[model samples]
Target: MSTVLETRNLTKSFGEVKAAKSLNVGIGKGEVVGVIGSNGAGKTTFINMVTGYLAPTEGDILFDGQSVVGRLPRDITRLGMARSFQVAQLFPKFTVLDNVIAALVAAEGTKASFFGPFTTAARRKKAEAVLEEFGVANYSRSLVSTVPQGARKLVDIAMALISNPSMLLLDEPTSGVSIEEKFPLMDTVMNAVKKHGVTVLFVEHDMEIVARYVSRILAFYSGEIISDGPPQEVLRDPKVQELVIGHHLDISILGDAT
Candidate 1:
């Protein structure tokens, strides 16, 4: 229950628009906090600032009680915080084993030694273990092109997990996967992350996913947090209902089955 991440008066602005406004939030080790907000609610902006993709206009971010305001994304990651992109980032032509080895190499400051002994038995064993946890070990020798989009996402999550990050920042982890695949994928993720005792902060659109996975919810609207509490309370909040959840859950998507 120790504090893992904390933000104080966090703010981010792009010219006339303020994407995140005076945000203050805290997450503890092993906590899973869900972020729900409309498209322009600054959920992504908040994440960008925390993960070092964007600098805060004012205020500070503390990771494990240390200031991290001016650090770069890679530096932030090296310090045990890893981020997952909304779109799956993978090398389509590379073998699954190679893709993971590449991440390990980069993590070890040997990204330049692609074909070197960097992919030694030890690294391969580690990479293979992550793949197995994601249920994609069978596809280790397969090229990325041959895998399904859902599996690709699992791979992306596995890649992030391989870094052994202490805190994970995921932007819509289940964005492109099918409804049937979502729970299983998340199960894989939850189990693996829990094994590492990592804290999670994620932006997601699905209420069902939020209820199923998150221990708490932080709802945002127009670059501000409207509610921060348990799933039931946040979902039942009037401001959250009117601004983000209600209208959003009713939207029509091509694959509404998910």
Candidate 2:
């Protein structure tokens, strides 16, 4: 249970708006953590900063005990961190397999040579394996634009994982997926992460999914973490219930359902 990621006084601001305020947290290797918040609560800001998509205004980020401040996203990926976006980041015109091949090429730092001999037998094998792993093998030959959103989300995560990252951040993995498909999508994702032993930190809006999939929960309100602990404890907290989970829905129903 060693700390694989840590943030100290992590702060981000845009003009007068504070997106994240003095955030401090540590994530352990192989742990599955969920982040929950309403709009503008700084959940995405934390992910962006940790994954190097956005630089913090001030404070520090350490991955595996080394400072990663000011590092580019690609450099951070090379350091064994990878992320899937809330909106699936895919080349819509590319075939599902080709998209993964492109990711494989980029992960190899050969983006310039991507079109040339990049889809060799070995690379193709790897890409196919990734597609199968994410349960998107059936869509391998289809254009990304033609696939369902759930399949596209799987493809995006597959591409991120093809790099063999030790830690993975998923922004709303179940977003845009049908209610019936959410559990299956998460099952596929969680199974894949377990197979690779990758630490996971995901931002999700659905309390049921978060409670089912994550070992720990971090509740955010007004750009600060208001609760952090086990699912039952955090979800049942008065502040979390009022500010994040709310009393409108019977949380007990969610607990039983999950």
Candidate 3:
């Protein structure tokens, strides 16, 4: 795996508060990396800078060996990267099918073309296939407002996938999803990413999910990476154990493995 993304001494500040403090990390292609941090640890800020949503106060971000410092988010996406939000963003009034179709339509460049003839019929069919792949085929005709939060998240991710991104940045994919539906949701995401060779970098608080899904974990504390390694190593670290993993995993979850 080659380095697909890298940050050099990345720093950010808002007014008098420091959000990120001289951080550095490298992410390889096809790797699923987890970022765990408490509130105000600058996790979102870090994502923003990487996605070109916010310019860093200092340091640099390189994607695919090129600087992405001053580009816009859309510009970044056009370069084969897409990001999903913590709270799934969807056009509530639109039917699930339309929301996805809209993304497919938008990808072809016109928003109000209503005629649906921007791309070849083959491409439109491809978008519909993606929706079916995520198990949203049944909700295709339903309104986003009518669907459950988990389904909305699924649809949102499906829309992002329709773009065929090489790297996916997910803020919190399982946020509103029910516990029972989680594994299936994760299965869909991981399967799609792996089959497509899409790299993933996400922020999540759930230790179990990180352990099961990501190959590496990056622990952020007060705007800095305190630990980075395999799940067992990072979670068992005294530093991470005291901070992020404290409440989530007790003696029971970690057990004699300690």
Clashing pairs in 1: none
* Reference-based TM-score of each model: 0.93, 0.96, 0.92
Q: What is the C-alpha RMSD of each candidate to the true structure, in Å?
A: 3.7, 1.4, 2.6
Best by lDDT: 2
Model 3 weakest 10-residue run by lDDT:
249-258
Off by over 4 Å in 2: 253-258
lDDT per residue as tens, model 3, 163-190: 8888999988998788998878888888
**Candidates 2 and 3, the one with greater lDDT:** 2
Candidate 2 Cα lDDT to native: 0.92
> What's the CA error at residue 111 for candidate 3, in Å?
6.6
Which residue segments of model 1 deviate by more than 4 Å? 247-258
Query: Cα lDDT for residue 59, model 2?
Result: 98
lDDT of each: 0.87, 0.92, 0.83
Candidate 2 lDDT tens digits, 1-258: 899999999999999999999999999999999999998889988999999989999999999999999999998998899999999999889999999999888888875564567678988999999998888899999999999999999999999999999999999999999999999999999999999999999999988889889989999999999999988888888999899877764676446432
* Candidate with the larger TM-score of 1 and 3: 1
Order the numbered candidates by TM-score, best leading: 2, 1, 3
